[model samples]
Target: MAVQPSRPLRLFADYLRLERVNLTERWMKAVFNDADLSESDRLTHEQLSDHVPEILGEIFSALEDQDLDEVEPSIERNARQHGRLRWKQGYRIDELVRELDLLRQVLMGAIDSFAQGHPTFTRRHEERARHFVDEAISFVTLTSIREVVTERDRKIDEYTGQLERANHELLLKQKLVGELYESRMQITRSVVHDLRNFLNVFAMALQMIARAPARTNAALALANRQAADMKTLVDELVEYSIVLGDNNPLATEAFDLRVLFDELVASCGPAIEAKGLRLVHRFDPQLRTITTNRLKLKQVALNLLTNAAKYTKVGEVELDMRAHGDAHWRLRVSDTGVGICAEDQQRVFREFERANQDDVPGAGLGLAIVSELCRKLHGELRFASHEGEGTTFEITFPLRLDPGG
Candidate 1:
């Protein structure tokens, strides 16, 4: 009723058992010698060799039983462990792939050597052995990659949970602070909803790939892209949360003003170009250095620039910085696009309040954050907008943040 493994297969299994150490040594030598696997140089012998011996034993079991299914679970377990270990050791996926490829080559070479030494090992036996080793190596490669992906998914889920809990706690704190909490709570809800949508898309893509692994490359790429977008949103949410709280104090330092705007322009250049919009910036050549919170100022400028780039479908976004009298400096961001109507002008700085929420892609917190930062910096935030024309936002901050200094 059942077919037993041939004598050659049985003897091959015994050869694997007796030569496991030799096989492992050869693999290690190969890995250490590989230029792409240089990361292995940092690892101790035991760390690099972890779970590999068990994988060889499982390979031996597969050859002995003539059924890969009988030993696959154990193989998977060892392979997963090896994968996680490699990941923690800072191994890139390609490097892990290269490492495993080396192992496959080494094993195939060993199989050929074994065949050459034994007269009983016929051509048919050699082909079968090569097939078995190839199957095991292929399975190992897939399982290792899957385990890494699963780990990444777990981390993203954990981070999203943490952000949700932090937002909840922030809402409670804002509630006790004042009645303004209602508006903030609404903003928080909108942000969470948007984040959940991205996460859902990412999760669905991952599930589809899991179900049909053969068609995973494209789906995996989509998943990674969605994950990246989610991270960007999460970072923005964190910044908004910190701005909402009163605990974060301003850390001011005197830095070159020209250097700051130059960096900001460079950062926003790609996004502006994507929309086919021109970015025009004019900095007063006289303004060499300013004593202020460089990080907060950078954040404020970035938010304003990105907001302009997002809303303006055509024409140019202009950023201007000039001296306002002798006491202060004026920073203006103006965009040629659909402007805020007179009716919606009053609530422009309110949290989660967007005039064209449906037509635009934003959480409606850009101006709100800008308003809060201006208040913290003790500066004035003013804007001029026409219904069908364009909008200009300007902030006038004292030249010296500490008036006494």
Candidate 2:
């Protein structure tokens, strides 16, 4: 027996077809204009609009057919492809879902708008159309999400395996260098402690995603930020481990002091701005070039500047470069933040020690790493702090580092 499509649905599908071009334009505008999809700003119109028109066409066809069975395969294939393309475009899972959700909203809005204009679109007709449209959009959403999840899982597994192997080798080497074992253990305990604190916040954000659907975007953003912070912690830990394990001589090179500080200032701009703080820097006119391990120098300077920005709430962070003497120069980082108390001042250089860990967002390794690198570069690190005033960290280094130094 031949089954006939519903006349009302057929007419509604025709209306959708007529408005498909307009709907696609609306979807593109909605996505690009959305603040949550800032990543799309980097993409061109053609790249962002890929496969969207086709997806709309599938929806319209399914509407006309009065059954999704005829269009489900096409929808799945197109959606999977769209998901892969978005993945390659650096779209996060939340962002991928977000864009499509916007599309669904656009389609729903169009359906309501159409129903309002047509006297024939009765309450029953609107209900049937809404249910069908929702089903079609759900199919696309689930298929695309599955594709993205599969790829992400595969990449995570591969990276996890590589890290495991690297960890095993590192453990063997650490065992041979028995002196480094205690330092590494301190770092591990500190990392675990900080990670537990971060994970608690992350889990709470995930839990809120379902309980408060209105805040799903906010929750997802929190999760992404937490993940990024964790990555930074792991990277810093690896760099610290390398610094600890290294016994080789320092690598010396000549680099411009002004250029180095300029880069540091630029890198610190975003963080400083986010907290509504100012970054002020000055370089001695006579200090043109210095012969030293520029990389280590920059690392130490950056760690200090980053720490300054992190702790300062209402005032400016300053970086001052001055010629200490004919043979030495000093780098100073001053911040108007909650200064270290007299009691906690002695432990500032110790590994995994923080005066206010509960309120701060560091793994407590910045100054320790700064102290270690200062010794390696033959630089002397000194600081002055007052409980309510602020803190100043100054490192004095020789203008030229000899191989033995």
How does each model score on TM-score? Answer: 0.50, 0.53
| lDDT per residue as tens, model 1, 1-405 | 124789988998899899999999999988998888879999888998999899989988888777888889999999998888888888888988898888889888888888888889899888888888899999998899888777777878999999999999999888767756677677678778878887897888888898988869878887887777666666766778889786645677888889988998899888897899999989998787788888788889999998887778889899898888877898999999788999999998887677675446566778888998888777899999996678999999877797334
> What is the Cα-based TM-score of model 2?
0.53
User: Any runs in candidate 2 off by more than 4 Å, and if so which?
Assistant: 1-184, 210-214, 357-359
Residue 247's lDDT within candidate 1 is 64
The regions of model 1 sitting more than 4 angstroms off are 1-178, 199-228, 246-249, 355-360, 403-405
Candidate 2 worst ten-residue window by lDDT = 1-10
lDDT (0 to 1) per candidate: 0.84, 0.85
Clashes of each: 0, 0
**1-405 per-residue lDDT for model 2 (tens digits):** 123667877888998889888888898899999999978999998899888789889888877777788888899999998888888888988898899999889888977887888878888888878887788888888888898888888889999999999999899888868746776688778888779977997999979997998999999999887887788778777777788788987789998889987898889877887899988889899998899999889899989988888788889999999898899999999999889999998889877777674556666778888999999988988999998788999999999998694
